[model samples]
Target: MARFVKEIMSPAVVALRPDASLVEAAQLMRAQDVGDVLVAQDGVLLGVITDRDIALRAVAEGLDPLTVSCQSVCTPDPVCVGPEEEITTAQRLMRDHAVRRLPVVDGRGTVGVVTIGDVVQDRDPDSALAHISRATPDL
Candidate 1:
């Protein structure tokens, strides 16, 4: 079992500038096959934008993705965890905040992201979520 967030986090650190258009963010998400991207500037974490944010906050609101900026729709100052934080602590934070993912930060800045699936996979490898988490993403 993994004890720390870094052990199970996806360390890709997909990120974008605040001024980038939502379309650009979506394209990046497609290219990376990720659901979320960190909104940052000068290595400072500003916010997090997720695919759901685009669909619900922008598209559903009739906002033009090509014009709307990522920071405009992102969840600012999101709850974060350190790479060395215990898995249980991360899980608690997620539950408390009702968030499924958390950005892992340290002295080096945003290092990675830890998702509920990661915790599930590490804590219960035989669980359905773990199985789904391990499966290759469908196109």
Candidate 2:
């Protein structure tokens, strides 16, 4: 069987809300040690905000992060992938869009989040592979 995306994704994810302040988002990211957070509202996926978004879009542009909400800086409309999407498709999206993180969703709703590191981990043929083998098949 060919490898799939869900097989290689990280289950532990950090998420946030659109109403969250940029400062709040940054602190949360720092606390979680993650670069981005999946932005959701009422448990539905919306968009994602990253440290880079704050630094490059808000800070560099002289917007006050402490006063601004994640929705203000987050990519208004983010590219998304279903839990069942092909690994090849995901890779293409990341490469073409120049993004590093992607939020994964399933019928039950959001399942986990994946990153470039996740894909690289999948290639490790060890720790990640062990996890991959047990994942529910890609949708």
Candidate 3:
């Protein structure tokens, strides 16, 4: 049997409004124990905001998290994958885009998110992708 994005994707999505403050996004991440949040507007996916983006793009620039909108620092028009797509397809998309996660969407809307960690844990625990996915950030 083939593995699909839906099989390993995290369906409990934590999203932020485009107009939301980066502080709010950060709070959501802390509350959800996640490192990223989807930036959405009226049910439309706008972008992805990662913890790194908040740190590098906003904080490092001395921007006020209370004032910066999620959309302002998010990775806009992010690469996405469908729920039913093969896990390999998601991995390829992640590698090609230089991203660690991909939003999982369908005709209706975003159904979940797939991270390299998810793939590694579910499929190949010994692959290079798994190592990269599990590597500690250089900070």
Candidate 1 per-residue lDDT, tens place, 50-70, comes to 999999999999999999999
Candidate 2 lDDT over 2-118, as tens digits, reads: 567788777777777888889899889888777788788888877889989999989999989888889877886677777688877777889999988778877777788778767
Question: What lDDT is reached at residue 47 by model 3?
Answer: 99
Candidate 1 CA-lDDT value? 0.96
Clashing pairs in 3: none
Cα misplacement distance, residue 77 of candidate 2 (Å): 2.6
lDDT of each: 0.96, 0.79, 0.92
Candidate 2 error regions (>4 Å): 124-139
Query: For model 1, what is the alpha-carbon lDDT of residue 91?
Result: 98
Better of 1 and 3 by lDDT: 1
Candidate 1 backbone collisions, by pair: none
Arrange candidates by TM-score, highest first: which order? Answer: 1, 3, 2
**Residue-wise C-alpha lDDT for candidate 3, range 1-139, written one tens digit per residue:** 7889998899987898899999999899888778899999888999999999999999999999999999999999999999999999998998898998899999999999999799887787888877876776553
Candidate 2, poorest ten consecutive residues by summed lDDT: 130-139
Cα-lDDT of candidate 2: 0.79
